[model samples]
Target: MDSKTGAAGGAKSGPRVRFAPSPTGYLHVGGARTALFNWFFARHEGGTMILRIEDTDAERNKPELVEGILEGLRWLGIEWDEGPYHQSERTELYRAAAQKCLDNGSAYLCYCAAERYAGGDHAEEEGAGGKVRRVVRCACRDGKPTSAEGQPGVRFKVPLGGTTRFQDAVFGAREFSNEEIEDFVLLRSPRGEETAGQPTYQLAAVVDDIAMRITHVIRGADHISNTPKQVLLYGALGAEPPVFAHLPLILGADRTRLSKRHGATSVTSYRDEGFLPEAFRNFLALLGWSAGGDQEFLRTSELIGKFSLEHVLRTNGVFDRAKLEWFNTQYLQKLPIEELLPEVEAELKRSKLWKEEWASGAGHEWFAKTVDLLRPRVRLLPDFSSWSRAFFSDEFSYNEAAREKFWKKEPRLPEFLGQLAGALEALAEWNHDACEHALRGVAEAAGVKAGVLINATRVAIVGEAVAPPLFESMLALGRERVTGRLRAALPAVQESCKA
Candidate 1:
């Protein structure tokens, strides 16, 4: 079977990986990278990719964030094969698994109330591997069943000796001694507001993974601490746990964890800022994994073909915003004009610069040519509306800095532009060659360098000191608008020159 369709082919098909996210906030970039990695692995191995929502904590989980998570995943083009199953919906499944652990002597009930330990002075104790840990051991471990029904929390019965070890697909063999793991809570019994029994994350995650037949657990390395406990839970259920792969953490340029201070953490934020989805995916792929060569820019299909857990680096990946912008620029140049026009048009409309006449015929052709001319100059989608605004609307203002530098340099600027505009207007053909000939002739008549006339004209027409090439820009702007802009800027040029 072909790799693309290999997941469903034979009896022994492929791995089943999952991208489980909590609905506490919008899907951040780190979470998006995790989702992408899982998707890459699933597609590479011809396996299923599932989307699970770990929303057990209803109090902290915002309902609106569920949409954001799904939307972000869709925006990244990471499609899931299985459900967006909610842990909230499967409470009974977790409860049944907890009961099985109790019956098989793998778990016990703790009657110790949290209030008793509140004021107690408990020193930090050394756990397995000689690491310091805050351990809260229950007093009910003397093999006594609680008489009070459903009033105590259920804790897992960790083995007394030996270590729990699992082979991580990315980081290799990882071992955690049982002593390091406290008898963590599984099911919390009825309390003040939470009258109904609820399954803790440790319990719910393990149970769901087992039920869903997840063949590989691919997530961030921050969850490495919880893997051993999960491994024990999988053993208690008399089931084999899936392969674990802990991804490296995504850090900022300061080498710290990625956060709001790092800028544009959310996938939706990048989309709003005019980052192409393809470029964003490529950027995420390079964060922790690479193709093992010097190829920096990769398409999505190439990524799927080259993706492997072995290439993923164990070192933390830095979230470089500047690198992301560079990737955006590359993608802007690669995509066809027709494909990018819709987004550019949308941005124009959003900025109130779009005209109804630009949808078809000559006006449409002009807009397409303008986009082609400005494509290389743009780094983001919003740049089209901001940097290329003069192409779309006549209401654009001169950048103050550009005005001070170009127009304010001399009063002769308006006369030079006037001569050039007159020459350009009188041309039979208003193309790039005609525009350049007219401007060069005017410069020769004024006894000034060609660059002086060209730079001044650029500032006059585009309201900026920098843009696409002068003649090309004017060619796209057309003769009528170009002459009108020169006449309009003549007053500002005279005023700034006097100042």
Candidate 2:
């Protein structure tokens, strides 16, 4: 969909953006995608991207989780150009903005009990005359700020009669009525064991956006409802609102909003499960956005060059995990051997499948060749270790299904393996063509088709029915292991791997 019908549009140049996430948990996929979009917009326009931590909720904020979130962004190659400005550290900014609202009569003091608005931010309550409203405003309209002892929380005032409207880049023109809007809490006064008052999310976010001079706000569509409130806050502070582009929500394959039942939602979960960062970034970029055409694969450089809010999808993106795996598979096959090497190495090391021999020299040559042969067959980084575990170690199990299919079908497997192993051991120079010649000769002597030996040899060599080409696989696994595994799989020689 190339429709840019109502795009509020891009900044002139050097637009500032921010990816503000609260440090409550790991950076989920949706949050990661938002960060990616903001990052793409910033990089596309050569602008500054600020990382802001909205950690004002002291009781729920985990200091340890902040680093995890940062790590996730870094892992996705979403490096910020500015400080991961913590909202808690910037209370002066929010407090000052709240006071300006109070001084200007845009805000008021609520002498009501703290329990009056107990549900916290975005919580609605019944107003006068049994009417329901999004917030509880002070009856007297006493404009003031939070105090330490006789603490009465502050709230921004909503205009009695008017509608707040702003243009969205993806979803088009949107409006929220002032009468329907809530005079939500601006600063919550601390009680029991506490120090300073905390600015509500609306105040802190608006204040920071204004202070940071952010020109564009590219975030998830879930925050669309919060925008009108923030717009009011910006107007109260006499600041211009940024260009808002609320990205469509990412849903699961079932078309439901993404959640745990849909699969692992965190970015690190994919990272830990062997996803390539470039591939993952490429996949994340396509969710709720497009560079156009049948081209699914986009490099980071390509994405930065092509990314525009005009192409941002109005429809919610479906998080097709199978499609993501397909993307990972393509990268595994197409990326340079050098680029895939370290990732495979790291994966192998993690799985305890790595060898000291793969470090350098002739052994390194063998390792490199093995990766080349295995790369096409690999889907994930762990596949480098799991799919081809036999390449790294002496001990690896044959697939049960492979054993039943290939081994059970060939009654002469022991004789055939013994014959093939003998033929292989007698090779002068070991390579694909030479190994092929040996196998064919063995099959001819056994008076059976090469397919029989090929099947047995495959399961014996790699312990998997499907693998890289048999001859090349023999070369990568080297002359010794191939012949050894074949001989070992023989019932007479060793019943350990007998079908």
Candidate 3:
């Protein structure tokens, strides 16, 4: 669609959309969701996706946060095909656009005090059976002395009548009366003419969208009210408004807007917490969108091919923390072991479980097997270190609750496992079958259930009562380390037995 005509044209080129994020804070889920949608739309249509930093508000701008936003986008595998244009550097373009609106009589200079508002000392008339309504609420909106005084701010001259109608891609037709729309500011007044204050979002957005020829405006539904006002600015600036597709807001379990209380809203925080990039993207893509069918696990290419504004839910997307983990688990289980090995290795490094030998050579196969064995039960990459830490290093923490449960169940639990460890050490071949046979033989002779010995030995091996299959876990822990940890726990278990 062409920006000037707002018409669907031939196959000259595809949509030019942009994710213009304000670097006021870290890139959170809401911003990342918008970027993901924009990327999906662009890639699906074989068009360009531009990254624009809307950093005009210098007072709130954190230059450090800009890199964070970029990093989050790249981490999500959402790459742009064009420039990461900064609004800070485009102040001249905004100034010129505002000047053009003023010259064309579509905007006016307001010399009102710093406290000027949309409804305060402006025009008001009684409308429809004793209702006082505000219309064109700016003092200099009409033919007043258009002074560049009061460090005058420029305000758009909204039509006093008629309705501003636009077809929203998701919500369909939406109309707002011109009288109900406020005479919004284009640019804030400057302390002096030499330094013009930054353009308001109302003006800068329309100006930048026009300048960049953005054919689509895909953003959160929170900007719905701002659309009508921006639509007026687009008309006043003699540019057609882009096709607007407002996404539903992401909500918590209680249906309120997602925040810190909703848990870890930062995109990079999810990365730090070991959410796979593809899994994260899949989770975000499904937040407000549906690719049909009952299948929720869609690949990036699948998401791109299936994404459309038609399927975007008008209702808010609920961020289910458990559902996100489910997606991560699915990826963990199905992704290639080689692909998962590095992620597991990085996580081990973070937890100080990394060893150079485990990355390659003789130890590499064992590391890969350990990862593959544990991946089925993991929901995130960090679990490789946290849940199965003993597989990589012996300095793993034993859960006191689990330890006490097993040690106290049978005071002689250590005796049972010690004998089982010695039986395993005497094995002709050290493997899963031999270990299991040895452990069962010791349990049977001692008149104890094999499960008792299994649970107790698991705590001794992995420092936790729960893990992947016992024989598999023991195999990954290897024959020597398994026997060594079991024997090493004897003194601690002996102390617990007396207690």
> Root-mean-square deviation of each candidate, in angstroms?
4.3, 6.0, 4.0
TM-score per model over all chains: 0.91, 0.89, 0.91
lDDT of 2 by residue, 1-499 (tens): 1111111233335988999998956898889999999999988889888888999888546778798898898889888877777877777777788889989999876655445644433456567878876553445354232222366667778887789999888888899887677678898865666554689899988888877778889888999999999999889999889889999999988889998888798899999989999999999899888887778888889999999999999898888888899999998888888888888889989999888878899988888888888888788888777868887887888887877777776566688789889988999988888889999999998888999889878988889887988887887778888888887777632343353
Better structure of 1 and 2 per lDDT: 1
- Looking at model 2, residue 212 earns an lDDT score of 76
- lDDT digits (tens) for residues 111-150 of candidate 3: 7745454334455678788896645577687656334455
Worst 10 residues of 1 by lDDT: 1-10
Off by over 4 Å in 3: 1-12, 117-135, 145-149, 192-197, 261-263
How accurate locally, in lDDT, is each candidate?
0.84, 0.82, 0.83
What number of backbone clashes does candidate 2 have, counting pairs of residues 3 or more apart or in separate chains? 1
Which tens-of-lDDT digit does each residue in 180-281 have in candidate 1? Answer: 777788888658776446899999999888887788999999999999999999999988988999999999889999999977788999989899999999
Off by over 4 Å in 2: 1-13, 115-137, 142-149, 193-196, 492-499
True-vs-predicted CA distance for residue 150, candidate 3, Å: 2.7
- The local lDDT score (0 to 100) that residue 4 gets in candidate 3 is 29
lDDT of 2 at 439: 92
Candidate 3 yields a Cα-based lDDT of 0.83
